[model samples]
Target: MNHELSLDLVQSSVLAGVLLILGEFARRRVGFLQRFSIPGPVIGGFLFALLLLVLRQADVATVEFDTTLQEPAMIAFFTTVGLTGSLSLVRKGGRLLIVYLLACWTLAVVQNLVGIGLAEVLGVNPLLGIMAGAVSLEGGHGAAAAFGPTAEAMGAEGATAVAVASATFGLVAGSVLGGPLAGWLMKRGKVRVPTLVTASTGSTTTVVDQGSDTGSDSGSDTGRGPETENAEESGSAGYRKLLSTGVLVGVIMVLGTLLGTWFSDTTGFVLPGYVGAMVVAVVFRNLNDRFGWVRLDSGTVDLISGLTLGFFLTMAMMSLKIWELYALALPLVVILAVQVLVLVVFVAFVVFRLLGGNYDAATMAAGMMGHGLGGTPNAMANMDAFNSRFGVRSERAFLVVPLAGAVLIDLVGLPWIVWCMNWVG
Candidate 1:
């Protein structure tokens, strides 16, 4: 009854790939999964975790995985995120981008404070509260996996599992509530979606003329900034492009690991390796943008990001020891529930008004709920669903939400959360 099965690094990595494929397959087949934007990896990985939980409870063999590649994959994905954060894009977003970014940063701080405060009241580790807070909610599964080990090292038991679970809750909660919140705001304000006109040239062209007070067309330029130039560089064959990107990412990861190790040793402070990699990547990205030193392609970077994030997330989810969270379960539920309530209130009252309180603001509010409680993808899904229903796309919402949620928000949120962790530890 004590049998154990251990998988080596290669086997574990392959299994993670299979799980990713399985998740994608299920998503393709399941309509609700697509509607909710539930990630394939999460679907597959969580199912596996559930199976493991049942097997363990039934006294069946327990399996162990070697997640040696998980860290590297995580760092690579963050590095790609760093590469996307161009100063020019931020500038293009103008005043509204600054406001939205500030809102997201504020949310991270609020989430942590509320989480830690409720944790003390609930008689649970404050660090576990942090795990359930921004680390899981705003940070999503990626941040949960990255910071789980840090929390565990700082004496929080089952931090990874708890954070992962909290993130999953946020993903679903954000998806379910975002559109409704936006819809309610729009209905109350009598915000009307701008008419979308279709012009038929040689090819059919659709134009969005958003001249209504429902949204501000301040920074409505839909160009992707540096990505537009980079897309041309991606004209090479797919395999060659991927290989080149891999090499560049590998080199950056190495440098980042070294830089993080050095910083930690010198300052006696813990700096996650991904942080260093992201910093280096940001520098490289900006420098490349200004000088065009390397032919960096955005498409390839996105590809790498998708692949690494999928594999890393699957590995992290499948390895979760859910049984360890039983003692902290009640506190975790309370903290997550409160976090959801706070995000809803904040988006409805603060984020909507600040973003201009138009139809555009309503769409962006839906996006804020998406990324505020979940991740950027969830935010996009929320906005997309809202926009599709109204038959209008808020260019401003698409630009600001994805840019801030995915890149700029992390710039402020990460350091603040890290400081809180160090202080609590």
Candidate 2:
């Protein structure tokens, strides 16, 4: 009458790969999904989850997976993120960049506060609120996958499910919010696009290039453009770089996991293994930047990140227990609703004004809604839509938003979330 199927680590990993490919295939075929920038893994994995739900309701069978590799995959991805934190590049972004970075940091804090406050009012674990907050909103699926287990380890049931669900909501909400907001601002005829004027040597004036998305030196930093590619044979060179980057990530992950374990054991802290790996990566990146100690290529690192993140997210999504979210459904909806409302208001009033209230500011506001609720890719999509309609580009927005959203914002945001998780637990 009842049956169960359990998979070993290798089998589970192989299944995850299949699901990831399935998702990608679906995304390529589905027009609506492509429009909203919904991730492929979510589509494929969620469909599987739905099938399992139906099977369980029919009393058919249950399936289980061994996810021993999930944590390492997560750690490797975060380590790639760590490698991207270049303070020298931050300085190159100048004052406006600093302001945008600060705004991102503030948004992360506020997201957590709003989530925690709402959760307490609704009578759920505040840790779940943290998951719905920065863990998913700004951190995206990767963070949800990384921290969900930690929240569960601290006794918050269904935290991962809540986080993943919240992130899915955000991805859609962000995609929709950005275009309308920017369109309204543009139609109002109040904000005007202006050229940037830079003065060097107190006499020489240079006009910043308003064409390229990544700007000059930033191409390498954000892993954009072929210029960042290492010199070697075209096809084989890429494979070599990817392999080298994987090796580097592995070394850092091992060191970070050991460090996290030691720190947790010695000090009774709740430091996650990925956090340790990220920290080591940040240090190594900064030192390498100053000393040129290693042959680090951002393009290769980005590739590694993409591969690991896809696999981790697919694994996380497939493992989700939809039934666990049943009791928390109403509270989850309320929290997400408030989050969307707060984000729109904050971008309209605070972020727009703080960014100087020009056409560039409006474009940046769209990006804020994108990554503020979703991830950097969502932000880029929002900006792309806005630019395509307006017939202009906000090079400053493109430069600052992605640079900060993708890498620098996490420098402060991750530590803050870690602290909040500990305090609440």
Off by over 4 Å in 1: 195-236
Give lDDT tens digits, candidate 1, residues 1-425. 85699999999999999999999999889988887677888888888998999999999879999999999899999888888878788788998998999999999999999999999999988999899889988899889988998889989889999998998888889999999999999988888778789897687789987565655544358644444556656655777888998899888888988988999899877788898888788888889899998898788999999999999999988898999889988888888989988988998888889888898899999998888888888999999999999888999999999889998887778778887887787
> Each model's TM-score, in the order given?
0.89, 0.89
Q: Report, for every candidate in turn, its global Cα lDDT versus the true structure.
A: 0.88, 0.89
What's model 2's TM-score?
0.89
Q: Counting only residues 3 or more apart in sequence or on different chains, how many pairs clash (N, Cα, C under 3 Å) in candidate 1?
A: 2
Tens digits of per-residue lDDT for model 2, 1-425: 65898999999999899999999999989998887778888887777887877778788988899999888889999999999998887899987799889999998999999999999999999999999999999988789878998999999999999999999999999999998997776666487655556677657778977667566555566666544354434767778887887898999999989989999899887889899999999999999888987899878998888889899989999988888999999999999999999999888888888888888888988999999999888999899889877678889989999999999999999989998998899
After superposing candidate 2 on the true structure, give the runs of residues whose Cα lies further than 4 Å from its correct spot: 187-189, 193-239
